[model samples]
Target: MDLNYYDTLIAVADDCPVNGAVVPALRGGKKTVAVVQFDMISADPGGLTQEDVLFETWLRRRESDGLSESERAELRAQFFSRSQACLRASPLPKKYGWGLRFDAAGRVTLCPMGSDEYEEIIAGEVPGVNVLKAMRSKRA
Candidate 1:
């Protein structure tokens, strides 16, 4: 995977409805927004060579389907901006690999950075630190 691809993925994920928007309250009644930003310039393609082009094409197609060029451009700009905001707002850990982890109670947990479901899980209103275990166990 290319680093640029990863960054683009993250950016796109940030703008997704599942990722949503987060508004953190700061001191003095102020609000702060954090969004995700991708640095595609530094990405290095490791194995999948066509990934970046494919993703770009998808975006272009979606933008061009039924809207004028200006409208499409505006939508794309908004999407990218929102994606950056979401990235800045969230604190996603660096992904190392893909696998499952088990808790002491023998519950299953999946830590996948590439999963589209990640944002939904994180945005869900659930209590308890072991929610992931419950979630995965339920899926099982």
Candidate 2:
């Protein structure tokens, strides 16, 4: 399938054949767990976009490291637009055992595979909810 900039639900094998592995905290991975944890810990349940999660984490941890305001802003923009690629490439559903649930406002939250919640959304049981699997490890 042709994955658009914001495409949802590109399926991947449960086990990655290329690496023959499932990395819980894959180095340089999308930090899937971190993204989910951030939402779970936040005051609002589904308020942040995928870009918001990445930028907030970056700002909190590395804001003072070296990047200037303009550069930081640019980087955050890259996460959302103009750079290319979509959240289908994110590791949350690719390697980690989770599914992505995009709400009506396009903000997303993690729904682990086979869970009651995940299945509920996948079964078309949630209103204004978009469910998409992560990109697969190998070509279809």
Residue-wise lDDT of candidate 1 within 1-140, one digit each (tens)? Answer: 12121211222222223333232234365322111111121132232222232333335435456677787567656555442321212222212222122223332233344455444444543223222211121122
How does model 1 score by TM-score? Answer: 0.20
Q: Write the residue-wise lDDT of candidate 2 on 41-109 in tens digits.
A: 244555666566555655655534677889878876765554534556655556655565555465655
Worst 10 residues of 1 by lDDT: 33-42
Candidate 2 similarity to native, TM-score: 0.57
Q: What is the lDDT of residue 39 in candidate 2?
A: 45
Clash number for model 2?
3
Model 1's number of clashes is 13
Relative to the true structure, how large is the alpha-carbon lDDT of every model? 0.30, 0.53
Clashing pairs in 2: 9-132, 9-133, 12-136
* Alpha-carbon TM-score of each model against the true structure: 0.20, 0.57
Model 2 residue 120 CA deviation (Å) reads 1.1
